[model samples]
Target: MQSIERAFDLLELMADAGGEVALSELAETSGLPLPTIHRIMRTLVSSGYARQQPSRRYSLGPRLIRLGETASRSLGSWARPYLAELTEATGETSNMAVLDGDQVVYVAQVPSQHSMRMFTEVGRRVDAHATAVGKAVLADLAADSVAQLLERSGMRAQTERTITSVGAMQDELARIREQGYAVDDGEREVGVRCYAVALPGAPAGAAISISGPEGRMTRMSTDTLVPLMQRLAEKLAAELRTASHGA
Candidate 1:
């Protein structure tokens, strides 16, 4: 058990180092002796979970991407029923999204029954700066990390209401953290509004949202829907924890 823990600890250290690191860096960060880390990293590389770069830096390998994608698919399948419930309860389109790299990708969705409802294409990737689910996921991330991500992604305006400035987006994320939910008031689309909450303990960068027309999705409606999203997010988080441990 101790050995297994050490292996996982080293893997996490690599991930925290942006999925790549020199052996010496891992030794310094993990406080594990060089020989011990060397053996563990050899095991990881032989098992196809890590690869030694030409520079002698080890990086997370391609095999992990397959494992991650499979796990993400399973998680999306497990989350659909709950999203359906949210859609049914609120009469709005419910969505499940995961942050991949710098984009928010919709994985699962339950469209509203209404003819005029919002519908986000599943598998569609959108810049995190212009959407509610993106904001919700970003809200829980450290301010500096968020800043770094936005700096890389370049907050392009999807609509006139989209947050085009880092400072404004930072202020909004602060409010989201305090309020426990995030909102997009026609920021991504001219006529749409969305309410989102992060799924703590779920897949990394996962968030859920409900969206509808601005006219129907009013302030009073948001007050009610936000709590509903919070409740569902907690339930989903618990389910995700169970699934993770089982996996």
Candidate 2:
């Protein structure tokens, strides 16, 4: 049991370090002896759960992909009821997404009962630069890391409102960090608006959002919706953490 705990702790440390870490860095962060960390890492590497990089850093291995993907699928299944609750509360579309690679993927959604509503299909992938969920996920990251991500993704103008410059994206992300939420005002799709809050402990780069047509998702609606989004996101994060720990 102790070994299990230590191994999981080391994995968490690696995840927090962006899926890679040096042995000395892990020792420092985990307060584990160098030898112990070394032994555990060796076990992990041999078991194909960790990979030794050419630079000698330990990176999360490909073997974890199946586990993560499976878990994400399960998460989506359990999140539908919460999303349905959000839709009921807001009378707008509710969505859950996670940052997968350089794109954000919608994992779950609940449509509003209104004749006019928002729709983003589950499993749909969009560049992180043009979506509210994307910005909410990326907002807390270091500016330099965000810059690199944008450079790699190439922030094309999905619509005229899509932030097309690194400087502008940085400014918007800063605003999101300040407000603890992100808004997309027709950036991804014209006449659509969305408000999103990050799920801090839900999953890697997970967020929940409420979206509707601009005529309905106005500033007045934002005042009400953002708060609800935050609360629900918090509840969702707590549930996800509990589930993860049990797993």
* lDDT score, candidate 1, position 59: 91
lDDT (Cα, tens digit) per residue for candidate 2, span 41-97: 999999889999999999998888788678668878877888998888878899999
Tens digit of lDDT per residue, candidate 1, span 54-120? 9999998788878867766777798899899998888889999988767888888999999999887
Best candidate according to TM-score = 1
* Residue clash pairs of candidate 1: none
User: Could you estimate the TM-score for every candidate?
Assistant: 0.79, 0.74
Model 2 misplacement above 4 A: 1-69
Itemize residue pairs with steric clashes in candidate 2. Answer: none
Prediction 2 global C-alpha lDDT:
0.87
- Candidate 2, residue 118: the lDDT equals 89
